[model samples]
Target chain A: MIRDTIRPGTILRVLVLVALIAFLVAPERFAGLLAPLTTNNAPPIYNQGSLVDLTLSHLFTVAISTLAAAVVAVSLAVFVTRPAGREFLALSRAVVNIGQTFPPVAVLALSVPAMGFGEAPTRMALFLYGLLPIFENTLVGLSTLPPAVVEAASAMGMTGRQRLLKVELPLAMPLILEGLRLSAVIGLATATIGSTVAAKGLGEVIIAGLLSNNLAFIVQGGVITGVLAVLISDGFQAVARQAAKKSGTRPQTET
Target chain B: MTMLADAGPDEPAASWRIDRLGVVIALLLVVALALPFATFRATRIASGTGLLLHEALPAPAAAAAAAALVAALAGAVTLRRPALRLAAGVLALVALALGVGAAAAFLTPADNPYARIAPGSGFWVGVFAAAMLVTDAMVRLRLGPAGRLIALAMTAALIAALLASGAWSRLSLLAEYRSRADVFWREANTHVILAAGSLAAAVAVGLPLGILAHRVRRLRDPMINVLNVIQTIPSMALFGILIAPLGWIAANVPGAHALGIRGIGMAPAFLALFLYSLLPMVANTIVGLNGVSRAVVDAARGMGLTGLQRLFQVEMPLALPVILTGIRIVLVQNIGLATVAALIGGGGFGVFLFQGLGQTATDLILLGALPPVALAFAAAVVLDAVIEISGRGKP
Candidate 1:
């Protein structure tokens, strides 16, 4: 269905998200993934081993937050995207959009009071704000099931849940997975916002270095986080593609 | 038509429960309004004044509670008829006016009722009154799903109004909320313009990038990836990064003074907010473009359409939903990120937030945060309406 999404699109996407996540989970992996002979000025500090510990925490937080986000998001998607639920669909999505659109930094900043300081509030903010993508995608994927396939499933005596689990979900898996992939990457990137709240993450390094004018620290931090996001995003995308391929489903949008 | 016969079974109990819940919520609100009126005590109203922050009830806050009771009952009773709803809403507002006049009837400085009614518990009671009144009117207007939704929506609005009005009193820093109705309108207007500008910039930047990536396969990944990175950087850090370079440019650039560059005005703030917004705009564009079906493209081409012609006519038109999707995303994000711009000499709504943070003033932060939020909701509704009107890519 992707009309103009550019070519080698997958690889750039892989690099984009993989690079970010690698910086977090396996900085060593990220360093090795780089093409080695880079001419870019900012490459060296990214390859260095200075930010391993900090990157780990950021990765861990994002991973947890993404998982937490998935439950709420998928449920919300189910609620809002149903035909009967359409009235509120736009509104719910809009709410999610607002949540995400607000700068993660703003969420953390606004949250300090009442919610008080620490990782708990940051996590709460991240979870609340980061639910849009997956929610939107999951709803789209589930709702747009081809009539023929759904009819066939019902004709074959499949139960409603079975049809959903077997036919619809599989068919929609690719796009849904893509949404998750992007959401995961976005979540990881925004996790840096948590640093402002004094939550432990690579953001702390980035924020501290930027404020303190410690270019080396900034370089190290940015590179590591960027690599981490890329790697994880790539992995999700690969899984998405595999899922799509397994389903042998035609893309929606036949003219 | 055949698929309709094979439609999946729904959870009867679940659907029933939701309907019940909606009605239940509406009833609870109605009950709350009426019940409180019975238990309500008619204590004497209070009067006092100092800073906006220092206003308190001259008499016990019980009187304010009594007013809340009256406002709620009045709201509940007046909302039965469409015409009456508006009239009652207006009448209660007038009663509120009289209450204020009575409270502050004497000398106006240390004895102003404006502070007492608008501050602390008075402000809270006022919120309850406003909520009851507005919710009552909304129910009569026949807005769907509002019974349950309005409760939450009204609460949020009330909280935000409380904070905004606090700032408007101008007794604080970061953002001085001017309490006069005219000043309030001005601040609200500023927020609207800020939101509009943000959406405009995002749409302008995103649409082209989406088209470019769609046309050039190799460009897609890199474009989307760049957006992803843009999204990841926290606004605070982004601002921190932007300040040094931007401030340097503003300070050194020749003829900058003629450009309305005040060393730290809107320039750096816009840049920071703009950078952070790249993710949704770019990502939505990529997603939408990718989603255009091959069959449609092939059909256009087979019909003898040139590459450019098909790209513009078939492809972009078909891709409008996805494009709108991006717009929606960018618009929402812009509203929120606009606030963060206030932190570093950037102007928008964040001044209230940071000021509140610094001074422990919830009201100030709320003021800065509210208008953008309200605007986002308004924009979302308008965009959806446009999307519906166009019938873009919908089955």
Candidate 2:
């Protein structure tokens, strides 16, 4: 069963990696292939910046923001779920849930006024945008641990801290990672919008394409971003499945 | 069971002992004191000077605002009753709103059309904290759907009254709204139509497709997988990707232009939103249907009901709440995404947002941004109430 799932995922990962590499390393090579899509003598490939640099920066922005969001959200989740902090649970949950309704683009726009343009606002936006899913998932993961298992931990004389670190966390790792997976996917997609505010990313490529009416650049940027999101999402799923299997828990079905 | 017994005796006392409202009030007080109360700009779109509360408002008003905030904080810490805490929160919110408006009015020169005043970080943070306090109190009070709706209505009316009073007329956001009120309403209309129209389309199509997926086991995975792939694509990239093919169609297809099907306009934007709406709609429908109790379905079968009748009478009614949950999700999601539609000339609140971005006009951006947030929030609450009411009606 493990092999059945892992094999297809591995093949897909390989395929996507190759395509991403081709786009970054030799984007011009695809220019001839894309020429049919362009009109008005528009350049078939985006030339203002190397695709490699754009992709790296996009990944970097997503990485930094998602990391920051994970740290804060996971910690906040832990804080509220603890007995001492249980009183604040409803308030925290409301904040997390309601925060999700704000469109990420709007958040990005709002940040620009406060932080000024460039990567700062984008990162802030991504960080804020990434919080809800991770926080909610962490809360779910921690709270939903089977009561029997918890009792067993207590019965075995495990200290509260030890039980959390050793048993509960391990059991909840899959769902927690699922949350991280969601945050990362969302960050990756949202980071593209950061380009509009002069943040460097794959969105730069797309926006460039749109401004010039270059079909090729649009396709290149769109394909690369879509593939990147899919691959990362798949990778997260594979890891989550592995974690769930190790912990003897069922992997959550995708919504 | 042992664990429950272990915690049961002291849990209620422990939970009620701590005043969580105190934390929110403390945060509010800190925010009120620490950040700028308002920003005074020389002209619209120019960087503003942040003014502390003392500097922004007249001495008496500033002192009064400070006194109100301190009182709220004290009340939060000392008050044992939820009602008192709730009142304190409302008082703090009102004081902050009026204080910010007063600051705007005070800071703006009487004859300067170019000068603008905006609420600074302090005001925004205080508002958030006050709102949190109110929400926390409401949750603790265990207000039902009707109570919550009443609260929402009261809040809306308060805001309307504030706006009508012209207390915030000097605020840059209001100035931006005043100048482009016509454009604002038009874009607001566009935004709602884009969100609601797409949702309607998704429901019309997704319901049958969802039913088909439920009936045909083989088609389910592929259908979901395709939608997932579509969902994975970034909205900006997806919007850009649609332009090429759509533009080609518009140019070549004879009636396409006449039908308002073009590369960069509502067509692509509407289509993209429609596409994004489908997954939640279909997935929820399937999940809701699958959630129907097997025994109940069997009982319906035993009653000589056909498969179609069983589905309609037994399955769908049971699934309505879950399906409505899906609709809620799509509606909120579409409302947010519709803002991005402005990028392609789809003309929604995003028009103001992107325009504000281009001009570095903060108030213009807020004008574009706030409505959709309000709309999505309102939709979520209303639909949640609907879902709850429907769920309660279930047998």
lDDT of each: 0.55, 0.85
Candidate 2's residue-wise lDDT over B66-86, tens digit each? Answer: 888888878777675668878
The regions of model 2 sitting more than 4 angstroms off are: A1-13, B1-11, B14-21
lDDT of 1 by residue, B15-75 (tens): 2223322232234434433331211111112222221211222444336634544554544
Interface RMSD (Cα, Å) for model 2: 6.7
- Displacement of the residue B267 alpha carbon in candidate 1, Å: 4.7
Error of 1 at A95 (Å): 5.3
True contacts kept of each: 0.15, 0.55
Q: In lDDT terms, which candidate is top? A: 2
Residue B236 deviation, candidate 1, in Å? Answer: 4.3
Instruction: Give a tens-digit lDDT track for model 2, residues A61-177.
Output: 999999999999988888888887776777677776678878888999999988999999999999998988988898889988999999999999999999999998889889989
Cα deviation at B361, candidate 1, in Å, is 3.7
TM-score of each: 0.61, 0.95
DockQ of each: 0.14, 0.51
